[model samples]
Target: MPLENVHGDPIFTKINKVKKQYEYLTEDIETDVAIVGGGVTGAILGYYFSKANIHAVILEKERIAHGSTSITTSLLQYELDSNARELEEYTTLDNVITSYKLGLKALDEIEQFIKEYGNKCKYEKKDTLLYTSKEYEVKEMKEEYEIRKNAGIDVKYISEENNPFSLDLKAGVYGVNAGAQLDPYEYTHQLLDVSCNMGLKVYENTEVMEIAYGKDEVEIITSFGYKVKAKKVIIATGYNTQRFTKRNFGMKTVTYNIATKPVKSFDGWFNKILIRDNCDPYNYFRTTDDNRIIAGGEDVDFYTNIENEKLAKEKYSILLNRIKNMFPNIKDIEVDYEYCGGFISSQDNLGYIGEDPNHKNLWFCLGYGANGILFAILGGMMLSKLYKNEIDENLKLFKVDRFDK
Candidate 1:
């Protein structure tokens, strides 16, 4: 499951191979914002802060986005936790709805950035289709459709032939304004490139060993024997911040992913996000721009005596067989990648964002199960407002102390 003290991802070594070298944090330095992790959250923070002249500096323990962001299967759809509708039970109804709506807005904002900024990464916007093959599965989709509409989201049902997947679809949920797929690496690539050009300083191999929050400025000790001073700090360190935060956010949960090699005969592959209903042990799949298909899901808690590597190979074999049954035209496509990791989850599947409860100038952006990119966007937008003193009234639900007893 989740282990904070250890090196998390096995694929990190492969990703480090093709990464572009960036500037390093050699000695003590200062900035307006000291974002301690250079994943999507940190990069997006720099992206947004650069807009209003609040230049932020990123201090990553490793290379940028080499953590959880790289291992992600990178499906950008609005489909959230099953309990999204129950958000009103714990927090204000309007803020709950706003939080959900913000996800959609964040995707749109990213799309706009891609369009305006010439899409430095491999970003392709396509129809995000959710479908089911079971005859009795149509009702749940209809229910979700109504719930999404009620939550101020633009989602509805579409006919059989109109959906994006060529699979046997009995029903569908279509988010006309959502569903985006991008190369996780390329996405990070472009974001960091643009953010740096706009004055966001970044340093690799620099870990924030300790954070000393002060009323005037924040001081952080780096693993590289450097101390940083900044007006504010964003803890986007993923599971790495577990030992540093007041709240113990990391727990056990495992998710697996596998991708198929490019298919030549399957030329008419539908260009949309696909997710099956009741396929228990859920799965999510989407087509890549280069015509390969990335499908995964088979999330389970890690258990002992189960050979992790051998079991992973077996699960991927099962996945391939299932995909072939649905799309029979494809013939023996080789598997390109196999990845599995735990979601650095939260108690309510709602991220802990905004300022630290105890520290005035220290802020954090964390995720539950979903909302990696979505939460990053929300944090960027809210941080923008915070910089301008125009804070949203709906942000308190994501407070760090929501679970205090």
Candidate 2:
């Protein structure tokens, strides 16, 4: 599916500082691995593969980081869309805890990368605030808080009196050193730039139309009648993976996002921390380095409608109201940008990683959740290790066949 219209005018892409370019694939090439997307996921996989001394290439249908990556609000957190307390129903408490830890590790991995390569993505480490205003939902908030606290995570439960924000909160969790924000477009470009220097080839405007699996290698046919043969292939095509596999591993949803113009005053905001609520289909908000308030959350089923502007306007209006409801002090909050994007969510609310059970030399790194970028980092590290014959048992937690068990 084409994502040109799917990801609307996101604010990050509008002020992107990094302006790197790449040539499109004009001839057939061979590599140890071929990544089928150029978003942050594929860029991440490319970086890891290069570090592992594997010859890899990234094939992007459009310009790099021009897809859903550009539209990402990039509130990087260790927490998933479903809290640990809710996730334990589908898996073990141990597994849920492990997943949360893995997410934290992924954030560290990103930090390490920035340290080594310089912070070109405006990345910053911040605390995350997960709270609910409704007095009745305080019990569930405390349940989530206890689960993380028991797991040895650095978290504090804040009551109405202790809440830092001006808004009255029944209860909330302030997660320390557990959240971050970044410019996804810039990060993707930076990773790709570093990886390309380390033997990673990238091609833009190269669309893979078909795939042929062989005993030892996989061949991907391009839109312009070119072909790429590789020992393995990683599909990081986001919500469009249904085009290649018939398995119903995830469902798609349409999410609306809006960014406010840079503001002068941020009174009552706690360290400008990432904020989300306990409400269903929750609204999440964070600030950009430029002091623009970026928030999103109204979601609808994507399969029912491809792209609708009238509906998008309605959702945007709802999101704007949500922002005001959360922080009424931010006066004259003029919206600078509004967008819509498609994201996939899994049955267990965890990422799908590792190789497909049915296809040899075919792997998938579908990070389907609110924490997609963090899961992508974990997927890259695990998959690169898998390709190096250093298999980690944790892969079982994110295996594609986990639902079958």
Candidate 3:
């Protein structure tokens, strides 16, 4: 079932139109690989697998890219939701650094894709500012900065005196050319647009009803009473993986955002850097190509049905007030769009991407963090390598059984 729509219109769908659609699956088919979701992760997998000369098809329960992909803030950062220093508590510092580098590589891969194909999405490279208004967080931020700097990452520590923003920041970490922003909806379709010509088959309005695993092949029965046989299956269904596994892998949360009308200027702000704070339930805001400010934060515990219009209004009001407090210069600021949606963060703050331990040839490409898009790219690459019998040592860090006893 599709997740309920909670609030105002998503800003991305407003700016972009769906370019492609597929008829529902009504007949049995066989393929080398079958992808179970049509969100960004599935689209990415479809692109990589198709490019590798592997036959692949995407089965989507609803319209492609209409799920969580549409509501993404699309802030492509190399940093994780849990900073490097914090992640070290869960894994080795070496592993943490490797994950960070992997994020940089994924970001570069996206740039390359845009270069080879065309940038249908509004993609742009930008600096990132991870700042803190609270004095207490300055120490941790500095530690994070030193760790990244020692690991050869381009970063700097800035105090309030040297801060470029009008906001009162006690300290901040300035990541040079470390982030990018784009229209995710357009990116998803653009990927499909390229992959479709490469023999990638995509079908929407197709739901997988049951799965029967075999030693050599996996068979999926769809709601339309059609069978799909594949040597391997990848579930990119985002937070709806309960139908396959029930290990409590995903930590779902409700996040909110408000997009303001295009502003005339960013007068006193820093170089349009992707800005996020160190505060718990931190606030993040960035500017779009058309000059609109999209800011989001104030996450709450997940609720199944978030379609409460009144609650959405209240949430938007709070978000707008926060924006006003941060940028007093954006006078008469009003929200042109507002929305709330569910997203998953993993226990270790890293994404899970590997074959299922109990089921051979059954794989997962769940990118379960704020770096969902980047992790999706990583998953696609790694999974493709795994299928071709190539070793990817990075998979050790994101093993699906990492939390298993």
Candidate 4:
């Protein structure tokens, strides 16, 4: 597939200027670990490995944080895009509980990093609210609310008066110990910057063209005609994994996001709650600590003519209209930034993290399911353990071979 698409505004322009220090595979160099893709997941993996005093090198096809990670609206909340009730059917009881709890653990890791590293990014522990306008769905959501509560997940349901939108909430689910978000680009850059300072190496515009695995080391060939060797290779590329490996574990879907101009004096319907509508293809909204309303969706895809800009123009119009309808006062504001990208999600919505069982020393941390941030953090911890030949019990649910059938 060709690189670069006509989606997403230029949000990560800084990474483009970071300069590539290590160039080409003229003479093979060895490292304890090689992490591919500089998105959030790969960056986190690099940071964790460097902390272990292991020599880790990260190779990116393009600039750091310039992929789907930057395109995300940065909803770091634990309220999953996957319906909790729906998940119980596809996965085992143990897996479901582990999956639900993992979000908070990831949150804790991020909070600790910010504290230890100093108040760097816009990290804030926030509350996420999923609500429906329709009364019937509200009734159904109450059942889901109970499912989480019964599992000791600390969730609650919102009655009509409790919601900010005048449109009565039929149902609402709340998760408290769930999340934190900063500017995706800034957050990613900080991790990478600090990681580099700690002796971890990051190379930009250095895409891995091919991989040939060996008994002890893996040979990575890049498009720019260079090769590097690493004891363990971590495939940190998201959505692009299908292009390079077995495609059984993940599938791709398109999603959209929009960042409106900073609002001056707007009265929002809700106070610091992320809201999700029960509409067909769901719509979710959150507020930045600075007061700008950032919103996006569980995107819906359609036929597109690459030459025509009709779809983009129409999508922007639709998004703006929805924001106006929900918060009547925010109509005149400018939609200065917006983004759209393809997200590679798993069937059960949990990311694939750990060493490839068949190929020793070949590890991957593919972001799947609902929470990419949560999965990315989870991926780092799991990979560090797997690198030391420690089996992470949670990894069984994400076995790439299990879906071979």
Candidate lDDT scores, in order, read 0.70, 0.87, 0.86, 0.72
Q: What is the lDDT of residue 352 in candidate 4?
A: 80
Q: Alpha carbon lDDT of residue 232, candidate 4?
A: 86
lDDT of 2 by residue, 11-40 (tens): 877787547778888898888999999999
lDDT of 1 at 188: 74
Query: Tens-digit lDDT track for model 4 on 9-115?
Result: 73333223542334433445678899989888888998888887788998887767778776776677665666766666677755766777877788889988998
Which candidate would rank higher by TM-score, 1 or 2? Answer: 2
Q: Which pairs, if any, clash in model 2? A: none
lDDT of 2: 0.87
> Considering lDDT, where higher is better, how would the candidates rank from best to worst?
2, 3, 4, 1
TM-score of each candidate structure, all chains considered together: 0.87, 0.97, 0.97, 0.90
Per-residue lDDT over 197-230 for candidate 1, one digit per residue giving the tens place of the 0 to 100 score: 8888988778788888788889988887788999
Colliding pairs, model 1: none
Please count the clashing residue pairs in each candidate, in the order shown. 0, 0, 0, 6
RMSD of each: 3.4, 1.5, 1.6, 2.9
Model 3 lDDT, residue 101, Cα? 91
